[model samples]
Target: MNREPLVSVIVAVYNQERFIGRCLRSLLHQTLSSEKYEIIVIDDASTDRTSYALELFHDAIRPVANARNLGLAASVNRGIDVARGSYIVRVDSDDYVNANFLHMLSIFLEMNGYVDAVACDYLLVDDGENVIERVDCSERPIACGIMFRKEQLIDIGLYDESFRCHEDRDLRIRFDKKYRVYRLELPLYRYRRHDSNITNNAEAMRQHEANLIRKHGLDLAASNGMS
Candidate 1:
């Protein structure tokens, strides 16, 4: 018999053949014990060798292949549906994290009874792994580097599948309203910025941002931070 995993790390991928291997490798190398965490990789109907790359880690990761491309939010939701852990963390396939990422975040959550979630500082890197800038996440933190209590997120309805964009901000809005998300100053995550990033679709993102504002019924002033 095996012990239940303490954390479920969800990695959502979409045609990330070039980076998925490195991402999975980084995860496999986490300082956290293998038995302590479960890696759930949701492949969003990749057309490239992303699936093949993931297959290489068959023993380490539980792969979920989408029949069709359901996009990021839906893919994440799918992973959450099957996740079996006390805590949940989201990491994009194109991005990778430091070895101590899980140990730091998980221990913090376990110790801080008041904090519902925790996020960490991240380095914004290009495809070449060159540092673009360091996002201390001084203001609004990103959804990827944060770890949330599984029950808390499930109670809040997980990721909004309807939101193809601004899903993180939408969840944060509702999450912050009920629970607190603490920021760890340590740079434990490496956020990769590339042309394929969905944020590059300005028009689509703007439309989604509008939809998000409408959904929450916020004024223009408050809408600026929608993403």
Candidate 2:
């Protein structure tokens, strides 16, 4: 019998009532084995209709609610703690995936068995769920559609909660230190871009990213393999 769920998809939500439903819908409709993957929705003390929307799929999806409103970093780590899958995925509640999102991701991870994480290309969607632009991130990996190995994360100390927004960047540096990663050449997600996106808060996000680099004592020479 197969003992491992291929992917554990975690979507951390705050007050994203408007987009969470669409995001969940995309995940539920993925052309992947429903039994071989699990979808985790973490409602970070959202004071919006996000919870009611989540209940619509509570029978199918796993929902975790926090006691108080923790930030995104803390919330996603919560999902990681309970994830039962061998491989993991971190998606935002405001983003949606393609129909074969998990299916394609599973294929790539299985293809590159030695890699600790897989990052795929994505499309930028608008509030109306219409594609505004296609973002090909195969050249540069970000967290939006990143697929990771569960054990790798546990060994490297999951996402750093200190930096509120650039947690993904921090994890990338750490993961790259000990393991290889694959940049899959598939566009398998619809990364919704809106005014409320965490990256949209340029100042705060940049500060967090800089701090993460400095806090970890990371240098360009090391990450780039330069002498």
Top lDDT model: 1
- lDDT by residue (tens digit), candidate 2, 41-60: 99999998988989988998
Where model 2 places Cα greater than 4 Å from the true spot, the runs are 1-4, 221-227
Candidate 1, residues 41-105, lDDT tens digits: the string is 99999998988888899999999989999989999999989999899999988999999999999
TM-score of 2: 0.90
Weakest ten-residue segment in model 2 by summed lDDT: 218-227
- C-alpha RMSD in Å of predicted model 1 compared with the true structure: 1.6
Q: State every prediction's TM-score relative to the real structure.
A: 0.95, 0.90
Runs off by more than 4 Å, candidate 1: 219-227
Clashes by residue pair, model 2: none
What C-alpha RMSD separates each model from the true structure? 1.6, 3.3
